[model samples]
Target: MANYYIVGLSTIIGLTILSLLYDSFDMDMYNCGSTLRNLVVTAPHDTTREFSSKNVTFDIAGKQWKDVIVLVHIQKTGGSNFGRHLKANLMLEKPCVCQRGSKVCNCSRLGSEKEQWLFSEHSVGWACGLHADWTEMINCVPSMLDKFENARQKRRYFYVTMLREPFARFLSEWQHVKRGATWFSSLHMCDGHVPTKKELPLCYKDASWAGVSLDEFLSCPFNLATNRQTRMLADLTKVGCYSSLSDAETKVKMLESAKENLRRFAFFGLTENQVDTQLLFEDTFKLKFMEDFIQRNDTNAASIKQEDLTVEQIQRIYDVNAEDFLLYDYARDLFKERVSAMRARRKRRIPS
Candidate 1:
C-alpha cells in the first residue's frame, strides 16, 4: 500500500466531519475512508509460495493470476473488515461496482484490469459491499478461464465469501435501516445489499407489528418479483434455522450443527468459523501482516442498535433470505467437503 498512502498533510479530523456530513457511501470505511478513487500501480504479480517445503510461483494475466475473486459484501458480514483486508492484501486494478439498472455489478473497470495485472507488482484484491452476483460465475468464468490458464495455469479463482445466519442478518438489517429515512431500504424500492445479503426486514418489522411476516410473503411463488425473497433466505441456512428456537430438540441439534459448520472453516480461513483471524490469513492467503490487525469483534459494537428479534421472528428471516440460504448452504457444504479432502490428504502423508 506504499503507492496508496494517506496524504497526511493536516485536516485529519477535518476529513471526518466532511465524511459524516456528506453521509458517504464507502465500501472500506476504515482504510479507504470515503474516497472511491482507489489507486495503486501494480507491476507484474510476482510472488512465490512455500508450501510443504516446496517453492511455487504465482503466475497471472501473462505472468501469474486467475479471475479476480471478489467478495460481495451483504450488509454487515464483516464488510469493512473484508474490504480493507482485501485492498491491503491483494493487488487489484481499478475495481469498481457498477449499479446499472436494478442489478449491481462488482467488477474492475474494463481495460484497466489488464494493465493492473500486467504492470502491477502484486495481486489485486478487490472487494466491496456492492452486492455479489454468483451467476457472474457462470458468465465471467468462461471469459477468464483462457487467460487464467495461461497465467496461473488454473481455470478458476478461489471465489470466497463469508456468510451469517439469515435471521441474524435480517434482524441486523431491520434495525439498521429503520431509524434512517433512506428510500433504498424501503419496501417498494430496495437496494443491492438487501436482495443479496440481508432480508427486507424493514417492512417486516413494520409489517409484523401489523401481523405481516416474510413467511406470509414467501408463501407466494418465487417468481422474478419474489426472487429476491428466496435469495435473501439462502444465506441463513449456512448457520441453519428452523421455525422455533424454543424447540429444545431442534435447538440443540442446530447449535451443535452450527459449531460443526464453523469448525471446518478453519480450513478455508473464514472468520465466520470463529477461528483465529491470523490463522485464517496465514493459511488461506499464505501471508501474514498486522497479526493483531483487528480486535475480535468483526461485526459492530454492542451499543449499536441491533435487530431485536423474537425466536419466531427468525423463521420470517429464513423465509426472506431463502435464496441466499441455497447459495450459502451449497458453499458451506463445498467448504466442508474441501476441508475433509485436505484432511484426508494430510492423513495419507502421515506415514500410512
Candidate 2:
C-alpha cells in the first residue's frame, strides 16, 4: 500500500510538470513592443510637442550634441542620409531641454516644452549648429565658442563638414537630383524629376552649369573644384568672391588651421571614386549603412542615358575636380587618425 501511494505521488508530479511545459512552449513569439511603449507614457515626458518630424533644424539640434558642430554640407556627399541618421539615432537619444537659447536650431518656446518632456528623454548635454555660408559660419565661430564656454559645462567634441573628393561628390550631386526617377524630396523643384535650369540648387545652377553645353554638362560637372582656400577668403568680404585673396598659401593655411580646430568637429564623408561616387563613410563614420540608404539618394544606374564621350572630355572633367580629390585624400587619412584618437580617449574613460 505504501509503494502504491509513492508511485501515485510521483505520477501526479510528472503530469503537472508536463502540463506547464506544453503551455509555455505553444508560441514563443510575443508583443514585447507594446509593453516597452507603455513605459514611455509613464516616464513623465511628452513626445508630441517635443519632437517635430517636419523640423529639419531640430533634426540637427535634437541629436547627440557634442558641444558645437556645423554640418558643412557639400552638395551631394550623403548629407541627407547623415541628417536622417542624426535625427533617428543620436538626437532621439539626447534631446534638448534648455528653453532660453539663441542658436538657429534652438528656440525659446520649444526649449521650454522640451524641458517639460525632458523626463521623456536622456539627452546628451551640448548644442551644435549646422551651416552653409562659410563667411557666416566663420563670423559665428567665436561666438559659438563663447556660448559653449560660458556654460559651466561643455562637451569635449566639436566639428564642421564632411566633403567628398570633388569629382565623386559632384557626380553624386548630379545623380542625386536627376528628378523624377529617385527619392530626392528636394527634387520637387523639377518636372517629371528632371533638373531643368530652374529646379537646380543655386550652387549648381549658378556656377557649375552656367556656361557648359548639354554634352559637357552630362559628361562631367564643371567648376566644382574651386579650391576651399579660395572660397573661404572670397566669402568673407562684403562682396562674396569680390574679396581679393592676398596670398593663396595664406588662405590655404587659414583653412588648414580652421580644419585642424574643427577636425574634432567635422566628420567628413567621401565619395570613393570620381565616376561612380561610391561611399567613403563606412571607414570614416565607423558605421556601415544599408543599401536602401544609398538607393534612396543615388539611383542613376537604374535609368542612365549612355554618353560615349572621348577620353579627353572625361579627363577634363576629372581635371576640374582633381584638386578636390587631393584635398579629400589628405583630409581622409588625417580625419581617420583623429577619429581613432577620439575612440581611444573614450575607451580610456570607460570604467574598468
Candidate 3:
C-alpha cells in the first residue's frame, strides 16, 4: 500500500511538470495559429493578423489557383497597369495567352481552358459594363461568370483594387477629361436601375468634356469625377443612388459606406506604395509577380505641381473630394498596419 501511494504521487508530479512546460512553449504557437485562422476565416475584418504562417508554396489545386480574382478598376488609380500585370506578370503554371497589340488576354484556369480564374478588363473585357463599381460588380459578376462558362459551379471570389491619393486621383481624372477621355459607355447601374437624368445630370452637353478648364470641371455639381473613388466603392443604394440628398448627409453616409466597403475588400493596394502593395498582395494570395512594380512619379496628376495652385483652388479640390480624402486616409492607415503585421510574421519565421 505504501509503495503504491508513493508511485501514484510521483506520476502526478510528472504530469504536472509536463503540463507546465507545454503551457509555456505552446502559448505563442497557439496564438499564432489563432491569428492565421482568423486571417483566413475572417479576413479584412481582423486587421491585426493579415498573413498566414503556414507554408503557402504553390500548389496547382490550391485555393489561390482554383478560385477567381476580381479586380475593381477605379479610374486613374493605375488600374490599367495593374490589370495588365495580372494578365501577364504572375508566375503561373499556365501563363495567360496574350496577342500582340491586343488589350485582351486569355487567363483560363489550370486544367480547364473553358473556365477563367481572373475577371478583369484585360481578361473578361468589361463583361460587367465599363469600369463597374462595387455594387454592380458584386451583383453582376457571379451571374456573368456563370453565363460565360455556360454552367454553374460554386467558386470563391477574391476582390482586389487599387486606390490613389484623393487629390492626385482627382487631378488625374481632370487631366484625362481635359485630354478628351470619356466613359460615356459606363453603365452607372445601381440597385437594379440606372440613375435618371434628373438624378444624375450630365456635366457637359457635348460628346465629351474635352479641353474643359479646371474652373468649368469643378463648377459642375453632378460631375462624377468628384469623389469618384468613394462612389465607386460604396453601395449607391445607401444614398438613394444619385438622388438628391442634403450635402451634409450625403457626405457622412457616403464616406462611412465607402470605408466599410473598403474594409471588406479581400485586398487593396495604394498606387503610391507600389513596393509594399506588391509585398502585401504576394503575402495575401501566395502569388508572386515576375517583376517588381515600378513607381512612376511623373504621372499627369503629379505634373500639376502643388505650388502652381492657389490656396482657394486647393481648398475647393479638398471640399469637392472630402469623402475620397477621408477614405484614402483610412485605407492608407489600414494598409500600413497590415504590411507591418506581415513583415513581423515573416521576420519571426526566418532563422536567427
Pick out the ten consecutive residues of candidate 2 with the lowest summed lDDT: 47-56
Tell how far residue 76 is off in model 2, in angstroms. 0.5
Predicted structure 1, TM vs. truth:
0.42
Candidate 3: give the clashing pairs.
Answer: none
Tens-digit lDDT track for model 3 on 224-244? 888899889987788888785
Q: Please list the C-alpha lDDT of all candidates, in the order they appear.
A: 0.34, 0.35, 0.76
Worst 10 residues of 3 by lDDT: 22-31
Candidate achieving higher TM-score, 1 or 3: 3
Q: Per-residue lDDT for 128-152 in model 1, tens only?
A: 1124333222233333434533333
TM-score of each: 0.42, 0.44, 0.83
After superposition on all C-alphas, the RMSD of every candidate to the true structure, in Å, is: 18.0, 24.6, 16.3
Instruction: Report residue 293 deviation for candidate 2 (angstroms).
Output: 7.8
In the range 99-189, model 2's lDDT, one tens digit per residue, is 3442223211133322111111112222222223344444443344445334332222223344554444444444444431222222211
C-alpha lDDT of candidate 1 relative to the true structure: 0.34
